[model samples]
Target: MSYPDLLSFAAGLLVTGALSGVLAGLLGIGGGGIIVPALALALAAMGYGGDVGQHVAVATSLAIIIPIGLSSARAHDAKGALDRPTFRLWAPVIFVATLAGGISAGLFPGKVLQAVLGFMAFFIAANILLPFLERLMRRVHGSATAQRLCAAVIGYLCALMGTGGGALSVPTLAAFGLPIHTAVGTGAALGVPIALAGTLGFLISGWNAEGLPPLSLGYINLPALVLIGGVASLTAPFGARLAHRLPARTLKKVFAVFLVVVGVSMLWAAFG
Candidate 1:
């Protein structure tokens, strides 16, 4: 790595760190959802080749989510917003499902994963853009069986897309009649195990994967994980502070738009 390349990589991580931190704080959305594509682009720009760069991005993002999810879950637990019953019920299912997800990821070309991310990004935008879609989501309410199925799907897909559970989980919980706050907090709690299991799966599956950058363990990039965690940790609180003053509707609209662009852009990078 030349000095300029090193500088570019570091700069890329910093930008990813800053934005992810703010979004994590400002929106209940997890940082990894945003980080996956950004880090993919960064890895490509750093001259990494083939699918390995995107694989590293996904794995590293999951690795980064572990601490963030744990901290968030603890904070929500302290507030009594976490629903213990739900956690006990769903966590195991998520773990098993995500382990499956991890295995499945290694079996495919990277474009498939890119498509998953794209679909999720669009799904998120639709849910937010007209919260009415939530009414349809409500139909699945009150079925323990349905929730278990939903949990499996959410866990698998979120892991595949390198997101914490909240993007889809919170809404699902709310549709089941949990209060939004409880949903958010519980979703945060769920993310800890999701990330942990997903991280482990990715680490094992991508071990010695072709074209991974130096110092990578499986798909996880240690430097990106370390640096992003360090910087993003510091900015989350600031984003939280700013969240109090921002108009909720406006902020969500802006975030939704950005997600759409990121999703399409990743797809373009992968397919185009």
Candidate 2:
């Protein structure tokens, strides 16, 4: 890339990163909700090849989230909301499931992956909006086993969607009876494993994807990583602080509404 091109890329990346960072901090999400679609659109705008641009965008979004997850996790840990024992217990399963999901995405066609994303969005939205569903699951018995099962399912789905797993993990944990604050905080920590496994999987799977864009690191867009990761890291502490002060019940409901909208948008985009 030329100097002018580099400058322009940096400018765009900074803007993307700034917005992603604020959202990550505010919501305890790794900002994949924004990153995936935005990066896809940005890559296309940068003249990346039509065939592989979306794939690269998805992979790159996961790659960038690694650091963002770490930053958010650390901040949450400091706030005393992270459940170390639970994280330790479930990390291995989440790691493995996420890796599997990443591999599946890499091996699948773009259209298939898009459909998977759409379906995942719908499922996650349902999880958010339907407290009764969780209560029903609990009533079915084996609640402990059910929680682990839900976690595993979320891990796999997050991997497929190129997310940090916060969107599903947080709500699932909360539904399982953990405090909402604890769920969100621990969810941040959980994102680390998901991102680590998912990023590596993407790297391995996309190592030779045809027609890769310039300056790409396997499937990752380096400029986006630098910008988004950097800003998110810096702003996460603020988010942690806000999480403590806010009324968690209200915040959760508001977030659930947001998820529904996002889910519908993804569905429309996929099938429109």
Candidate 3:
């Protein structure tokens, strides 16, 4: 790449990381929604298109989420916002399911994964924005068996979509009767196990994949991971502070609107 292009790309990565880190702390989203799509576009623009590029994007997003999530979780915990019992209940199931999803990711088409991300984003946004849907979600609480089932699904889908699982987990936890802040805090904590297991699974599964980008270990792009992860971890605490200051209603609206944009953009990217 020319020096100008390299500079632009570097700038893009830094901006993406900053925004993603803020979202990770604010929404407990671990920055996957932003990172996965941003990395995919950046890779494609740099001539790394097609399935391998998408794989690299997802894998790298998971790798980046590890530190971001940890930072967000710590910040939330320091504020006494984390719901430890719920996190403990969900963590193991989420980790195992994410591992399974990551290991099997290569079996699915890139478009399929992208579509799943898009659709789920829309669903979560709708659940937040539409009062009836919000009411419906609230009415859907259940037993331990049911909650565990939901956690499994969240983990599996998060692995496929390269998300931190907060987009799904936050709303689900809220519906299960936790306060929104507590849910967000716990969701941030849950992201650690998901990212750790998913990263390992992707590393193992993509080890022999063809046409991977240079400086990649398996599907994870090393340069991108390091750059993004470093910047994101630094910014996450700021976001967590912001989240605490925002009202619960405003926070939900912010998350919902964010998801709407992500859902629409990702769907367009997937099928356009």
Candidate 4:
């Protein structure tokens, strides 16, 4: 790369990394929604070609999310909020389901993958906004059984959406009468499995694709991964601190609204 191109890449990396870090911190997500799209645009702008650009972007974003999730999980653990017993119960189910989802993504066509992402964003937004769903679940709740079921569902959805699982898992747990702090902390832990499984699938599936951009690792773009992952790791603990200090009610409402807007935007991107 020329000096001018290198400079541009550096600028792009910083901007993307900063934006992703802020979103990850504020929302308790691994910033996959923002990172994947930004990466696709950045790669295209940098003159990467072929029909595989978006796939590479998504895969690379997942690869970066592995470390981001680990960092966030650690922060949550420090707060004594993670549900270790519950996590142990659900981890195996989530691992299997996430692997299945990843394989599906890898085997599916590009248009189909895009449509799935669009639909998932909408579904996730609905889950965020509907407090009544939690009430309904609570009406039928039993000891441990309900929580296990919820975890399984959350794991499946998280894999399908290409998220760290916290996007849906945290809220689901909160709805089940788990304190918001515990839910968020436990949800963060789930991200580690999701990222690991999802990244592996992307790498395996994209291994044979040609015309990949420089610094590529299978579908992952190494430069973006390093930049986004590093900054997000640094900022996640701060976000955890903020989560502890802020009122859960306020954060929940704010996060729901944000999900709605982001969902709409993603749908627009997919169909428009």
Q: lDDT, candidate 1, residue 137?
A: 62
Q: Candidate 1, after superposition: displacement of residue 126 in Å?
A: 0.9
The per-candidate count of clashes, in order, stands at: 0, 0, 0, 0
- lDDT per residue for candidate 3 within 110-195, as digits (tens), equals 88888899999999998877745445555556577777889999999998999999999999888888889998999999999999
For model 1, give the 10-residue run with minimal summed lDDT: 236-245
The candidate maximizing TM-score is 3
Residue 13, model 2: Cα distance from true site in angstroms: 2.3
Evaluate all candidate structures by whole-model CA lDDT and list the values in order: 0.77, 0.73, 0.91, 0.70
lDDT of 4 by residue, 136-161 (tens): 77776555776667666655555545
TM-score of each: 0.89, 0.89, 0.96, 0.88
Q: What is candidate 1's lDDT per residue for 130-211, written digit by digit as tens?
A: 7764687678666778889888999899767887777778767766777666776788778777888888989889985787
Q: Where does model 3 exceed 4 Å of error?
A: 131-142
In the predicted model 1, the residue pairs found to clash are none
Deviation from native of the Cα of residue 186 in model 4, angstroms: 1.0
- The candidate that achieves the highest lDDT relative to the unseen native structure: 3
Ranking by lDDT: 3, 1, 2, 4
